[model samples]
Target: MYERKPVQSWLTDMDGVLVHEGQPVPGAPEFINKLRSSGKPFLILTNNSIYTPRDLQARLTRMGFEVPEHALWTAALATAQFLADQRPGGTAYVIGEAGLTTALHAVGYVLTDFAPDYVVLGETRTYSFEAITKAVRLINDGARFICTNPDVTGPSVEGALPAAGSVAAMISKATGVEPYFVGKPNPMMMRSALNTINAHSESTAMIGDRMDTDVLCGLEAGLETILVLTGISTRTEAERYPYRPSRIVGSVADLMDEI
Candidate 1:
């Protein structure tokens, strides 16, 4: 067996690992503070495209966590970067919010339903039937489809709401077109994050609570993965998957000395 070296760079999921339901998880603040003080590059990754990095930073700050705006990496950012690389100055028909639209605009992507190069789908509080219909029609007319993440449902103050993945499925059903998801569970997203932080997979570790997205993404990208039982996934549930994380811990609290 090849001996793996100690992890240097870190990539962590935001919601489950660091905070839960907009509240800071135990020891999350200290762990983040350590990462910041250690002079190591780390990013709080999320598949949620509803809010931009600044918005998310504010949300976290309000929750008593001190994550900087630049420290947050979102699916919206990854998706926009992918689009800009694939087709610079491309036009898209976006069915998302300011986070998604702003990212695309920053990359010189124009939002239009008219002869668009891509029919982009992202997280939105309100999935307007009119907007979805326009996206479907645009795809049917030869627009390539793209989705931010594969999560079908997202939690709201009230309850679970229909997310981008849910609407993407509906559009696929109508137009017989499947979207290319650019978020977690996609190795592209992990590689893109690595590029952003200027880190190598061999020395980086990914910390997440979900096996399907965070752990899987890191594993596929050839990085060591740590699963924390602080959110959606339990130890028993994680064992059911064929893919395994390098380590399992109770929460971010336990990793205090590791950093």
Candidate 2:
């Protein structure tokens, strides 16, 4: 069992914690509104790197969330930030959606079709065999492999779909190259989220639905972890895990009773 603690800042997951299958989870909006009203700064952190912050903000608005652009952070953004810090001005061979490409470009990276200095992978609906082959060849040619996240799948309107990790793993197996992951459970992602709020680990809490990624990431980063059952992990499943959250709630609405 885990014990609850006080927190000054929050880093929250989006898909499972706030919404599911394009619909807002019950009490998500209220919980967020309360956080905002209380002046407890929070960021919407997500492993899905297919959309930019602006795109995500628009989607949240469409789903009736009063979200600001700066409150959003995606794996794509974190990956770009990490790459920019590691190898600035490098050309990248990208296998992801427009958002990942856009983030890389914003970080002063040039996107190329061949012989890139780095190979970047994320979520892409149009991923093809040729793209995978090209990425593998580039890795074999000495390009650094960078994966936006390690999530094998994410919830979607149709159901769970293949995420970036699955594709990255396939390429890694083919080329015998492991990638530097930039999403949840990785310290880099947690660091980026903390920087957004200008807070330290002691003052921060991670509220999410998944145990493997979100809860584990929060624990690794030394932040209080709050698990909400509104998403993927059920109470039964969560109980079976060795690593438990500091607190567990039925939904975001239940947060009202806490903070």
Candidate 3:
């Protein structure tokens, strides 16, 4: 029988596992403190591409979570990294906020709509019809389609708003071209994250609140997956899936000792 190596690094989802509705989850702060004190390599992962790591770091600081910008990873960064690897110094027609645009710029991607290399879609507060129309026409013209993530709806103070996936669907319907998503549940995201931290899969653990994205991505990335109940998934709901997490805990607080 083979044995897994002891966990030396950690990757955790930011929304449900750490915060919900703009409030920090119980024991989340302590867990973060523990990781900091232990000097263990850790990252807070999120499929949200609206905000850059610096922006997210500030948001977390406001919420009393002292997370550094280097400890944060967003789908925007992952998508930009993937694109940089696939096509160095490429041009893209981008539809997103500062996060996605800034990331692409950092990776030497030129954002334009005129016969670009790719039509990249990401999360935005305002999804304009004109922009979507441009994206659709561009894809029909020959540009490849790429999406930051496949989340259909995102939470807001009002309610769930149509997200990147929803807009990607409309574009796909028009052009009959489906985009390649580079965020959660895609093992590529996990691999990129692991590479970012220089952590090995066998010695890293993933903590997530969702089975569809976080747990699934971690499992596929060969990291031990820990499902927590503070988010969208419940213990019962998790069992409905074919795969199971390595462990299930009430919250991040439960694993404080592990760090």
Best by lDDT: 3
- State each model's CA lDDT, in order: 0.92, 0.88, 0.95
Question: Considering only N, C-alpha and C atoms within 3 Å, which residue pairs clash in candidate 2?
Answer: none
Residue 36 local lDDT, model 3: 87
| Candidates' RMSD to native | 0.9, 1.8, 0.8
- Candidate 2 C-alpha error for residue 213, in Å: 0.2
- Give the local distance difference test score of model 3: 0.95
Q: How many backbone clashes does candidate 3 have?
A: 0
Candidate 3: stretches off by over 4 Å: none
Q: Which residue runs does candidate 2 get wrong by more than 4 Å?
A: 1-5
**TM-score of each model, in listed order:** 0.98, 0.95, 0.98
Q: Tell me the tens digit of each residue's lDDT in model 1 across 104-195.
A: 99999988878999999999887899998888888989999999999998766687887888999999999999999999999998999999
lDDT of 2 at 5: 51
Backbone clash pairs for candidate 1 read: none
Clashing pairs in 3: none
Q: What tens digits encode model 3's per-residue C-alpha lDDT throughout 93-184? A: 99999999999999999999899999999999988999999999999999999999999998887889999999999999999999999999
- Residues 145-204, candidate 2: write the lDDT tens digits: 999999898676777788888998899899999998999889779889899789788879
